[model samples]
Target: MKDINEPSTAPLVIADEPVNSEVIKTTTATAKNSSNKKSAGVSSQMQLLALAKNFVLDGGLVSSDKQMPLEERTQKRARIAALRKQENLEAIIKKSVNYCSATEFTNKADADWFSTFTELAEDVSNTTMQNLWAKILAGEISQPGSFSTKTLKVFRAMSITEAKLLAKACSLAVTEQTKRNIRIISGAYQTPGLLNFFSKNREQNITFSQFSLSYADLLILADNHLVFIQETESNPMNKSESFHFNFNGKPLTLTANKSSCVLKFYKFTPIGSELARLISDNIDDTYLQHLKSALSENFSIIEG
Candidate 1:
């Protein structure tokens, strides 16, 4: 976060290398051109990328062949590349903000988010350039709010698609609550060692496999700390023997079955809860209420 204003990198300039200076000078023209005309946007972006590369190569060069030893040159170049990449990322975020101005969702809030992300650009990965840009655009073109800088920083390092899938899966994992916590049915997954719930009342067991989520996707959420997990033998009372959820608007009945005593699963962490609140929508509220009511019918809190 060093200010770009602290005495330009003039000392790093080599007398013979005027190309870097020229490229740097043209950046203003490119940015201005992109700002003034939407038609030239593509060309402007290309130039910005080019200039970014040029800055790294030019900025890292030793003033004289003997000024720095050859052994350290590679390391110096690597550091310069990271700094240069960050600079380029700033440019990209800027362009995304400019493009947002024409969209219905664009507002001062979006601008603030953009600026926040821009400040944190240096820490984000640039490998998924297109995806990053798309996510940025999506944020701007929708509800804009101040996301947790720390949370988003971790998110920026992760795959956007995976984060989205995890979000969707969490939405589907809802179940009518009882004294025991709900275990989502392992739909489409014939994986062994799945400990689930079964009905003790009627002959039928509930399974809402229609709203299935991949086990792998849920694992990713756990890995990203967006969800929590624990592995143990089922010990809670009035839990389930089979892992099934009610698709119909009926209370899901569950009993503990001794078929698979071993268990490995995810539970929510504090951070995971925070993420769920951010990602989950009002669509799940009714379902949650149903679960709570069902649980309250049979479960009660014990006071010490």
Candidate 2:
């Protein structure tokens, strides 16, 4: 795979409007003086002028005049909106190409899927969001069924904050080695059996807040149907039985030291599983250690 840090040589066809000077001025006001402020203002003006040249129609930037008829002004505004959307689409396409592999894909993206993607992506002007859309496009091209239409709709509705929350959850996510099912290992349940007859049933759960992922964040994910609202438990494992799991890309083998050991977790919905593929694996050493300590009570952890 090519390094993502390597810059692309491709040029953007049209640049968006320069960011407002007021935002920059407000941030740097205390650190800079009057001369610096004047230079910042002049720099912003030059950028705006450069942007105007990119959108020049006939001879000048698409600007409205009160002298023109109402219908003409309305048409001009619509044309400008269309041009802006076009620029957004081009920028996303360019970014997507960077993610595409040199190897050709055997399958092509569906017509309906591509159509829906373009309709939704054209209006996404935020650079961060645009990069996500581009990655979605590239993923679909590489493997047509990697993401479903429903997944796309859910993603389109997600705000940057919600997306970040999901990413945070993914950083601590785990999965069975042989299965693609994703889950958050919140706790474990030790069933009332020969090993724990006196204690009845024992349960151990780690609060997500300790790991910087709060319950409120989980509620948001559940509301979005990315994760099940209720906690799920695995089938009881007999003593000496072993299970393999992948945690943040690392493989682990866990063998039950006691009978009726049930692993408790929050399962990801189908939509969640699909979108989770987009998140790069980010290992949390502290979280992993905590999980190991908890599981050590009933199982032996073997890293692979």
Candidate 3:
């Protein structure tokens, strides 16, 4: 017999049965999850309310015009448009900060350039375009005059499709090792000589269409001022002449096998070259092989 006041040496029971430990654990977990969700909802609502308050403080637009006059409604519409533009500018500024290099800016951007940039950038609503704008801003800040105002004017007029076309062109563009001029080499020709007076000059060219860039595409690029209006030929190279070029960021050397080896190519304009700096090197293996195969016939091709 135990004293009535003494504690009993027995497990606590619910309804005269053992409680399920697993069930209790699961119930507690569910309760915690519900609490967390409620807290998260409150936080989100608070943030949204803060934003709404700020917007209202900044002259919020009327949600509806049940009894508003036409003039008043038009004014409200313009205000909203301006506010949206301000928001876009703010977003671009934030994005530009992320791209700032650790190195101090070498020079300050021109005031006129910045003024023009803001005017055009405010109208850019697409995220991709916004990012591009941000990069331009960052680049200008790092090195003033890196991009010309003319380039900005041209780029501002470009559509997304045109931008993509430019990017594709950049991927195919090549530069000489010692020069920054970018060009798209499509063909090579041996100048007509006395031996071929009655026959056409020997030429080897690759169809750009097979590489996903058609002649029509080139025309579009030219119309946009991204490339020259016509295909240009380089001065003929003498026999055994060696040239160094950077193809898709790789070094390539070509030694001419015969005299008067002229290259047919499309040259990028100054504005185009400036914008091309923003593009990364993306090598097209098939196009590279095709170019090499064609050049091999007239010269010795070496790639590194």
Provide backbone clash counts, one per model.
13, 0, 0
lDDT of each residue in 151-199, candidate 2, tens digit only: 8899989977788888888988888776579999877767886657677
Residue-wise lDDT of candidate 1 within 38-121, one digit each (tens)?
Answer: 332244343444444444333332345324455565677787778866766766666556545453644445555666666556
Clashing pairs in 2: none
What would you estimate as the lDDT of candidate 1? 0.45
Give the least accurate 10-residue stretch of model 1, judged by summed lDDT. Answer: 1-10
The TM-scores, one per candidate, come to: 0.36, 0.75, 0.75
Q: After superposition, how far is residue 254 of candidate 3 from its true place, in Å?
A: 2.2
32, model 3: CA deviation in Å? Answer: 36
User: Cα RMSD for candidate 3?
Assistant: 17.9
Q: Which model, 1 or 3, shows the larger lDDT?
A: 3
Q: What is the lDDT of candidate 2?
A: 0.75
Q: Which stretches of candidate 1 lie over 4 Å from their true place?
A: 1-107, 110-116, 122-134, 137-142, 157-220, 228-304
Candidate achieving higher TM-score, 1 or 3: 3
Q: Model 2: which ten-residue window has the lowest total lDDT?
A: 1-10
